[model samples]
Target: MTSLVTDTRVVFSRELRPVLRDPFTVIFSMIQPLFFLGLFAPLLPDSPDGGSPLQWFVPGIIVMSCLFGSSMTGSNLLYEMQTGSHERMLVTPLRRPALLIGRALKEIVPMIAQAALIVAVCIPFGFELHLAGALLGLVILAGFCIGLGALSYTLALASKNKEWMFWTVQQTLLFPLLLLAGVLLPIENGPGWLQALSRINPMTYVVDAERALFNGEVLARGTLEGLVAAVLVGLLGLAAGVRAMRRSD
Candidate 1:
């Protein structure tokens, strides 16, 4: 068990080095969320209670950051594959599952950091967050990112050398999930079919939970539901990613 943990750490360190060096990548990832905060957030009508629209919008932006950042993790794996580095690493002493776990875990660091940045930026815009609830929300977001990152890596493995297909599949998967989660607007106010679809989307639960958490509703049903959905996604993604890695071996 110790060895597995150690190996995973080593792999994670290796994967994270490049990200640390390329600070611009992290900045670029935040642009979309910041854009929403800057442009779209002002258009939202003030609540009857006089709360800023930022209170409602920030949670969705955090989740959107997770969605976009985590989903693009595969691009790194795809690069390694094209350069033959992934195959080279497979021949090393590292356990097969550790490789995927390491890469997936690395995604969580940038995700949480970006989330923190988003929260910090929103504070001036009147976004309110409870300390304890923010901590729990971060945990939920981490789980979701780990799972999504694993799935992204798994998709990369499946796509192999086909760069075009990998991107196509990623776009096909990301936009619908984003739209269905209603990050840009409330699905409840949309068409009936859209509302129905949002009900089934796990991301919707995540976003709802985040909003509740931001409002300090720590014990809300949405919080529990979102945590469960995020855990399930993590487990499923880890399983699939591990299986895919082992197959590559």
Candidate 2:
């Protein structure tokens, strides 16, 4: 057990070094969320419930940041695969599960940092959140990130061509999930079919939970549902990712 933990940490450090060296990648990842926060949030009409626009919008932006950032992780894996870096790692003494765990765990660091930055920026704009709620939201986001990052890596490993993975992620998966999650606008106000579809999306629960948390409603039904969804996603993603790694071996 100790060896597995140590190997996972070592693999995590190896994957994280390149990201640390290229700080711009982190900045670039945050830009889209910032754009929505700065430009789009202001244009939103006042909430019917009397909350500030930032309060209503910031949670969605945080979820957006997590989704976009983590879902794109597969592209990095594709690069490693093409360059033979992933294959080289396979020759090491590292366990297959550790390879996926380490990479997936590393995703939590940047995601948490990004979530913190988003909240800080929104604070000056009148976003209100309890520290306890904020911490809970971060925990939820961590689970979501681990799951999405693992799934991304698994998809990358399954694809024979990098372009296929890129196309599928961007064109097929990302936008549909984003739209269904109601990141840009509330689905409740949409037509009946759209609302129905949103109900089935796991991300819908997550975004709703985030909004409840941001409003300091820690015990809200949405918050509980989101936590459950996040755990399920994390388990399923880790399972699939580990299976993919074993197949590669």
Which model scores highest in lDDT? 1
Q: What's model 1's overall lDDT?
A: 0.88
lDDT of each: 0.88, 0.86
* Model 1 per-residue lDDT tens digits across residues 26-127: 867778778888898899999778988887888889999999888888988999998999989999889998999999999888887888899888787678
C-alpha RMSD in Å of predicted model 1 compared with the true structure: 1.5
**Can you list the residue pairs that collide in candidate 2?**
none
Estimate, for each residue in 8-29, the C-alpha lDDT of model 2 and write its tens digit. Answer: 9998998889788886677677
Say which candidate scores most in TM-score: 1
Quality of model 2 by C-alpha lDDT: 0.86
In candidate 2, position 86 carries an lDDT of: 89
